[model samples]
Target: MAFPPQVRGNKVDPDLLAQLVPGTSSRADVIALIGSPTAKATFDDNTWLYIGEVTRPVIAATNTVLDQQVVVLTFDGSGVLRTVERKNQDDSVPVAVVSRATPAPGNDASFLQQLIGNVGKFSPTQTDTSRSRQGGATNPGNF
Candidate 1:
């Protein structure tokens, strides 16, 4: 069975993007032209990003990226568009993942130890009959 390519993120239209003039377009004009951006820069609010990707399912819970697009827009402090940048899959860099696991503060116990760990820790609950209201009557309904 073949799976279709899944489209994700904000896909910007080329014709609409062309309508945006860096020095002339305002923040509201960009939003009106291409909707809102998918994300904004973490440290800079003036920078906005529109990201899109097409991916196909390869294995269980894994996807193979077929195409990617990113449009970066920057606005001046006065809210006028200052610069527009476009990037594709070729511009992306692969990041390496660390496999080292952090050790916890507790000691690791064996399966047998876990099963028998609480064997004798609990005791049967005892009741005090001397404080009973009806002189240690076994059943309150009997009276």
Candidate 2:
């Protein structure tokens, strides 16, 4: 049997997210009320956060719904919830990604040069174990 990654066909519940409030609900309350978040940050032990996202394309082959969520909680010096920031997928400006590869400064050889280099690296003498009677060394060279 073969199994590949597949996406689910349902959207997340925004109604549940709309009910979240700071300073009133704790971590345990959040879990009991809402589900676990995708990711979280540990700025301190007193606070927590949750996030969600979705991505879609036009082409069926490229069409995809990518969901991402982040949770962040910050605490004070006395171990109290200072702040909680939950980042989710929202309508925002797109960021560009640039990639460039620089060739390493070195000698690039041709096919003949590569073949000659490999041939030159070949050992002049090699040992054959099949001809050894007492399990010692045996000469493989014909000459």
Candidate maximizing lDDT: 1
Error of 2 at 32 (Å): 3.2
**Against the hidden reference, what TM-scores do the models get?**
0.80, 0.48
- Point out the worst 10-residue segment of candidate 2 by lDDT: 2-11
Which number leads on TM-score? 1
* Cα lDDT of model 2 by residue, 14-71, tens digit: 5764555655555655566665544445543454445444555544456454665555
With candidate 2 superimposed using the best TM-score fit, by how many Å does residue 49's alpha carbon deviate from the native? Answer: 6.1
State, as a TM-score between 0 and 1, how close model 1 is to the true structure.
0.80
CA-lDDT, candidates in order? 0.90, 0.53
Pairs in steric clash, model 1: none
How would you encode candidate 1's per-residue C-alpha lDDT over 1-143 as one tens digit per residue? Answer: 89999999998999999999989999999999999999999999999999999999987889998989999999989999999999999999999999999999986999899889989776543244433545566446545
